[model samples]
Target: MTLLGPAEIRELAASLGVRPTKQLGQNFVHDPNTVRRIVRAAELTGDDVALEVGPGLGSLTLGLLEEAAKVCAVEIDPVLAKALPDTVRRFAPEHAGKLHVIEGDALRVDVDEQPTALVANLPYNVAVPVVLHLLATLPSLRKGLVMVQKEVADRLVAGPGSRVYGVPSVKLAWYATSKLAGKVPPSVFWPVPNVDSGLVAFTRREPPQEDRNEPSQEDRKATFAVVDAAFAQRRKTLRAALAGWAGGPDVAERILRAADVDPGARGEQLTVRDFTRIASQRQSQAPHG
Candidate 1:
């Protein structure tokens, strides 16, 4: 395969009797430089285990296998998964065992338990939710470098007042210190996606904030209730939007007081810590029922 550039990728697709699946958001990278760039960005080591999703045609998987100690690649299509090992052997025969091509849906896989560097050219459809899923559920995985929709990358690292600042932004900031590493032009893809792509780096931050001690029982219910309520109507103020949810008014008020958030503020105005603090208070104020 020798890096599987676009010409090789296109020819391989023809020989393999397959086409890129739009349903799966399968936009294979045809540029080796982009491939190497993503590898360099990861800065892998023998200790690093990489979790890659949608390693279409095994191009990125080939690159990852060469760099990381272990690479677990989850591809939804069984056909693609079957083609991966032989494809990988062409570039990294020594890493046949190092590359794990799991034929399954990435959304269903639990990658956090792997305890490695999580990186991928994430399928566009699952990009944000996938990152959120891994970070939220798999605290074991330390860092992530993913190529995502440029707009999404922007939101993940957006400032408080920026248009991109919202739930994703707050959530990303709470989980990791995110940055827009680089922009990937549409031309780099085989069947170019209408939108441009960007590389996002999410490195774990140390010295965890004491405020996030895992939402207490009451807070757990209240925090989510508040989040759902506020975002239900982002344009609406907390009190107005959350009037229907239990303890939402009370929780929102106390959270605002503790976090110095405004009662009249909308959900967009609150940070991840603000929401986290609000949840804790909910448990304190309403321990029963």
Candidate 2:
């Protein structure tokens, strides 16, 4: 399959009257080598159906098409979405039938075919939210490789106690295990971005819930609430930060003690499992309505 290079990318964009927009975080990859590297990191199988979000200009989409059995691309820009199939037919006529384009927001878009993997160069602004949303909504996604802003990539792969570890880190931990696969220079993009990008590879796993209990959606909601509250004021101790969430400082301390956590500890020091325990403790002590 012929991948898009710098010249071809510019020519195509000019033809479509598409200038990269800051609002949509559109920095289209123009390097075929980078596309191949991302595809390789995805570790897709012949049976895998890859779900790609924000497949701008069909660069990475073409790469995914070459690997996965089928590639379902979700592009918010209707023009790009509509043009992707034709681009595939032009460059990879043999694999044109394997491409499916959905013109809608990745956060809310639904697909009929269950996708086994997610591979995309995600929009930087909504990268974290989009990944979390897809993981929550699509239980069929078993693994993924995504290109995101370097800082965002660090947060996604961070573990508990790391300085960058916070909401994104803990939230993603609830769904899958992630690590930094590689980095891409800005020179590879059409309208070269100011900062470099990083590749994050992830594999889905069971939520860090007690093995005896099946993972509960309600538990996830409750645990995430605790996580938000704890990190709402990073400098504050858990007792002080969680006061509003637990109804009061004393109540928050009691819940923390019950969960075997130190109330004086800060949010950054705790893992998702720790937050889960605190949520469970609070739920157990609450008055049953």
Candidate 3:
């Protein structure tokens, strides 16, 4: 399989009349070493079927095809999406049968066959939401690695009490255990992004079941609502932050007491379990109850 180099990427873009746009967050990776590193970090098995989002210029897609049994790439742009299959056929004819290209947004696209893994250099603007959506919808995605903006990488793996820890940290913890695998420099892209990138390696796990009973869909929604409220104002304590969500400061304190959480504590100090407890307390206090 021929790996895409800087010259080839530029040549392909010129041939296709494609310009990297900020709106689409289209900074294509042209470095072969970086592509291999991302695929290695994903740790695909011989039987693994990988799903790749935003396969710009088929750079990383080519690399994933090298390691994975099959690769399904989803691209949002019509121009790029139309061009990928032919690129794969021409560049890696031996593995062309292993590649499937879908033209749609990663967040809304529905794969007929569930993928065993996901590997992508996700668009920076929508990286976090895309990861969360895919993990929530595609249960078969056992593990994967993604390259995202460094700040986002920190938030994904941040722990309780960490300055960057908040919604993304807690919400991601509910789906998987993630950590920083490595960093990618800006010089490797066709049009370099201003910020450095980070590689996040994650393995899916069952959500915390602190109470023996697993939380239901409604329970999760309620809990996430509480989480949003808690961090809506970083400077406010839980008591004050949750006041709007809980109706009033007095009611917020009452709910906190029921949940065994300190009303004076900040949202950054709480875990997903704590948020679940708070959500349960609020549900029990509802007028219908």
Candidate topping lDDT:
2
> Candidates 1 and 2: which is better by lDDT?
2
Q: What TM-score would each prediction reach against the true structure?
A: 0.89, 0.98, 0.96
Segments of candidate 1 deviating more than 4 angstroms: 110-113, 206-225, 247-255, 286-289
lDDT of 3 by residue, 34-109 (tens): 9888988999987999999999899999999988999999999999999998998889989998998999999898
Candidate 1 local lDDT, residue 78: 82
How many clashes in each candidate?
3, 0, 0
Weakest 10 consecutive residues, lDDT, candidate 3?
280-289
> Cα RMSD (Å) between model 2 and the true structure?
1.2
Give the C-alpha miss distance for residue 208 in model 1, angstroms: 6.1
Question: Candidate 2: misplaced stretches above 4 Å?
Answer: 287-289
Q: Model 2, 83-190: lDDT tens per residue? A: 888889988999999998899999888877799999999989999999999999999999999999999999999988899999999999999999999999999997
Model 1 residue 25 lDDT score: 91
Which tens-of-lDDT digit does each residue in 176-275 have in candidate 1?
8888899999998989999999999888764224364543434434555656666788787876675555345665565556656677988877766677
- Considering every candidate listed, which one attains the maximal TM-score? 2
Clash list (residue pairs), candidate 3: none
For model 3, what is the error of residue 232's alpha carbon versus the real structure, in angstroms, after optimal superposition?
Answer: 0.5
Give every collision pair in model 1.
218-283, 219-279, 219-283
